[model samples]
Target chain A: MWRKVLTFGVLVVFAASFLLAAPVTIHFWHAMNGPLGAMVQKLVSEFNQTHTNIVVKADYAGSYSETLSKTIAAVKGGNPPDLVQIYDIGTQMMIDSGVIVPIQKFIDQDKTFDVNTLIPQVRGYYTVGGKLYSMPFNSSNPVIYYNKTLFEKAGLNPNDPPTTWEGFKEVAKKLTVKNADGKTVQYGFTSGLVGWFFEQYMAVQNALMFNNENGRAGRATKSAFDSPAGLRVFNFWNDMVQSGVMINGGPGWDNANGIFASQKAAMLLDSTSDVGMMLRQAKEGHFELGVMALPHPAGVPYGGVIIGGASIWMINTHNTMKEKAAWEFLKWLEQTEQQVQWSEGTGYFPINKNSLTKMMYQGFYAKHPQYLTTVFQLLMSNVTPATRGGLTGVFPKVRATIEQALSKTFDHAMTPAQALKWAQDQADSAIAEYNSLY
Target chain B: MPRKYVPYVLLIPTFVIIGLFIYYPAVMTFQKALYKISPFGNRSFFVGLRNFENLFNSPSYSQEAFTTLIFVVASIAIGLTISLLFSLLLNEKVPGVGIFRTIVFSPYAVSPAIAGTLWSFLLNPVVGYVSYTLLRIFGIHSEWLTSYPLALIAVMVATIWQNLGFNIIFFLSGLQGIPNSYYEAAKIDGAGAVTRFFKITLPLLSPITFYLAIMDVVFTMFTSFGIIDIMTQGGPGNTTTTLIYRLYRDGFIYFNSGMASAESIVLILVMAVITFIYFKFVQRTVHYR
Candidate 1:
């Protein structure tokens, strides 16, 4: 009887070991939706098929903000996934959460990988204390998407779009048309007045969005939206909205997309990721779409824009093999081939320069000259600490306040200076409160 | 098992479930409100009452409080009056009464999130049918989701529309529950329609009115979260922000857990006091057999 029991126990142990030795399945939670989601799934499946010893399962985790909140909750509940994709604004908070397996660790462990190959501005947003916290998976900057048909009708050059806000306003005023009934047939400018868009405006001036070197030298103690640059942004939006140049289409990405898609607006200031969608839609419409860098304030050197999309984060699950497997996935995702494929598929900037050398991408750019505009703009913008975007514990809230301030200006409830000052105070208190908690 | 033990055993599962989900979370909220906790759930230190103090001292707190009060009051006043009017109409023997009642009650079936999205499309200032028609004809669409008081009014309109169904059902039942003979007695006594409505119908329906009042206040506090999230996002300078939205923003969005917990406690206190006032004074005059 004892020998039989021993044989059964041995069999059970061998079975458990065999099960554990099988391919390791790692869960990746992301926020890719729509066509971009299909692209991600394709890449994920391709990776899974090629790698026989490992399997990566990707979960669509809603929008960027939703994914962050879910990831945080899962951490507290002790069931976090192996990896997540966090947006740029959540960098400081992600680092402070202390739940990340710094990409630097993986790079150091694998001597063949070099972190410096990452685009400068892309790297700047994820670096903390000289170490990259997350891998820059996808990056996109703001661009001016113009309706060339409307531009030609308005007697403006489609190729030479506005480079400054003043120029844009003039162009918008010219392009705005009314029917015989005195109704607005086409507004010159309309965009979702979101907090993220506000960040692009500040970044183009090469201005620090927050004090303390955009919170890279130390923690951000105050918001810099009350400065001259911020006031200018507010006044531009306010004046445009109050006049008929820019229509209040309401706030959010969907409304902005709607206004542009319906051809009610001549120009749209939105992200580069929107290029693919806009181009596809334009092909079916009567207009030719053109892309340009985000406009700057007149006379000030174009300080340029920062990357504003999501990045890949390796969640620290405290198991060495799992961490190593996640890193392998990350390295695979960062390959030049994958980067070029991602850029071509999603209109996101290729993080690795080697991807630009790919003949297929060059062919893609030649076929669609509009696609080259964002790449040229990104290369022209000098990477600086200020243009890299701010890192703060309450960046998302600070942005909400900025949106509130901007909204107040457009609503005629408060002047630009007053609203910005109020926003500065609100941001200060929020940061102070956040610092106290951490 | 013995019969006495069976009752306890059956109830044990419910009590355990409630204890884990409800009582445990509530106690943790109260305890966490007194301490400073980071986003990662680390207990840095305790500062009792300071969370509450800081909340009141903060610049946006008063505005937030006023905003929440205005939202609740506006939603209740508008929702209650419209609901009562609809209920009165629904109670009458008008033609197609069933269809009218069904139409009034259908919004209750729509989730807040879906309703919010629908309203967002309807009120979109540029391409929306409502806004486009008004703008093309009148040269102004009020920028329903962009302008200040207009945005608040827009959200309130959605809130009232959502609660109107629940309010109508309750008031309809309340109207039905009253003995028809009372109305007949008033009619025989030469009481006019307005007088009978004021004197007999209003007084007899006090209990239902009271119940709806409490439910509306609670709904304004909690359920409007979805509409606010989808439609306005508490924007146009915090005109649409309420206590619950503030709690969500401070705690989850900003990661100020201590402040969020304190605000949660204050919201509970406010709801409790409102309830207390309703029960102590308002319920006394309610008619019951």
Candidate 2:
């Protein structure tokens, strides 16, 4: 009887040990902050709750640029997180880093996951040589956010926003309000000195910013933005600034948004990711907001705005268990439900094509028509190489060069042609230097 | 250990720290300046000073260097002058002098970035209180940050304001350390305030002034990154892009670590020359007593 009792106790102890085994932990570094960060935490906790065998640790790693730098430093220090979120412009650089395991590898191995389900424009930006390196998380494009009340006050139709650059200028001129003292009290349009907008304008004109089909066909050897298409965009922008229809909103997104929110500017060109915040700001400002697609230059076939924002990249740790666990979390994040949740929580539209078909999103779109405007813009965009966005390791530097060109043009220190030429030269040299090293 | 070795043994920790943190990084940066390094530092090849050559050939580098010189000289000259004036005034035996002293020194307690943020808000074109007041009263739309010379001036003004407290603290202490007997003797000699200031006070405070000048030069060169970044982001067509700001752009934003390292080496050399000149020529004017 004593021997039987000992065997029973040993069996119970063995069962307890097996039941209490440690779960695999996945480290995730992201750039999301504020309400979006809270949503990320909520999703992580929910995932942790349902998946008893896996625990995901999420960390807010500052801004997109900071996160990329921190991730690279961590990788060099031999303690990188399993996954990291990097901005759209960092795609080529991250790909060239040779540190990330392409998400396509897991997609190919996982028979249940469908790669084609992602929105083409969103997926195309992250795809290199027909393979997606990262999972599209937050995708956005430039959109015109106008104050409808201001439009009406300016004797313009609130529903019919301009679709062409010339028409945009004409409307902007009309919207500009001046006092009896010859002081302009309200400017018509304002945008930050952001190079992303320049790139979008180029895209809308079906213009390649760099050679080799915007670097998608191959590595871009030189900047192609000094062409007529580039000059047209620059000339239009310069004319607006020169004519005093638009105000220089300075160098950051917040400044332009402030100009609009304070009723100092009638329209603002900004990322669609700001839709939720813009809506709230409009409500606070007691003005009705209207959203529209970015205007294209006249007599040009509209290409479309390139996909902006960031994607989640899986770091190569050479540990299959950690890799698989991270991939599982990524796949879970791409689910229609989670996509809908993310879209509603943040202004970034869902990249999963199936999410649009869901009844939940249908109802959500019906209630908030402004959100559908960005979705329609994305759907209408042509999936050409120009719209696929430029792929170069020196994209950030190229963008800075473009911004400098814009600044020179705006300051009237250089004409549009001269500024673009300067930018082209600087960008080409930067690209050459980066290509040589990479 | 021998008796001589005892001191060396005690100094080991300091040597180790300095070697690890300062000398090691300096050596690494010098080595990196000769190579073309990938952004992640995974791959590199010796380029042998090509980065420095490229920088020298670039127009932007010269422009930035010029801007850096103007910023350093202007900030130091104007900053020191205003700080000396405020310190002298606060040095008077007036009522509420302690409060004035605290107010003058308060900005020194604030970080450069915080000072920059505060100043940016005050100087913002559309909604800034200063701009709004100017528009309302004078009808002048001063685009403080987006315009050319104004952008540089705005950055300088903010930097000077932020650094004023530091200079004031030093000048105030230096003033306090001045023996009252010297001023009494000057008064007896029938020396006017200005004459006394130029002759006695200025020369006697030369040591502190010289020290402050060197510190201010270094501060304006290296520590003005925050103010420039916040106010203008070295913008309006590179009108305000200083060498330090350029270095940050290359190293952090653009990920041109090799070029950044090269720029850093150049910066170190520039500072060394400046300090050398200060000690060689300016030190002779400094009076200890």
For candidate 1, the TM-score of chain A alone relative to the native chain A: 0.96
Q: Which is the leading candidate under DockQ?
A: 2
lDDT of 2 by residue, A1-438 (tens): 999999999999999888667678899999999999999999899899989888999999998878988988898889999999999999988998989999999999998899899999898889889999999998999999999999999889999999999899999999999999998899999998899999999999889998999999999999899999999989888898889999888877877788899999999999999999999999999999999899997899989889999999999999988899899999999999898888889999989888977834469888888888898898899999999999999898889888889889988899999999999999988889888875
- Candidate 1 at residue A238, lDDT? 87
TM-score of 1: 0.94
Report lDDT per candidate.
0.85, 0.90
* Residues B1-289 of candidate 1: C-alpha lDDT, one tens digit per residue: 3886988898999999999998998899999899877777753588888888888987678898899889998889889889989999999998999999999999989999898888988887778887888887787745899887888998999989988999999999999998999989989999999999899888888888888888898998899988998889888778888889889887777777877899999988997898897888677866576
Residue-level lDDT of model 2, residues B101-195, one tens digit each, is: 99988988888888878877787677778888999999998888888999999899988988899899999899999999999998999999999
Fnat values, one per model, are 0.66, 0.63
- Candidate 2 falls in which docking quality class? medium
DockQ of candidate 2 is 0.64
Clash list (residue pairs), candidate 2: none
lDDT of 1 by residue, A146-203 (tens): 8999899888888888888889889999989988777777899888878888888888
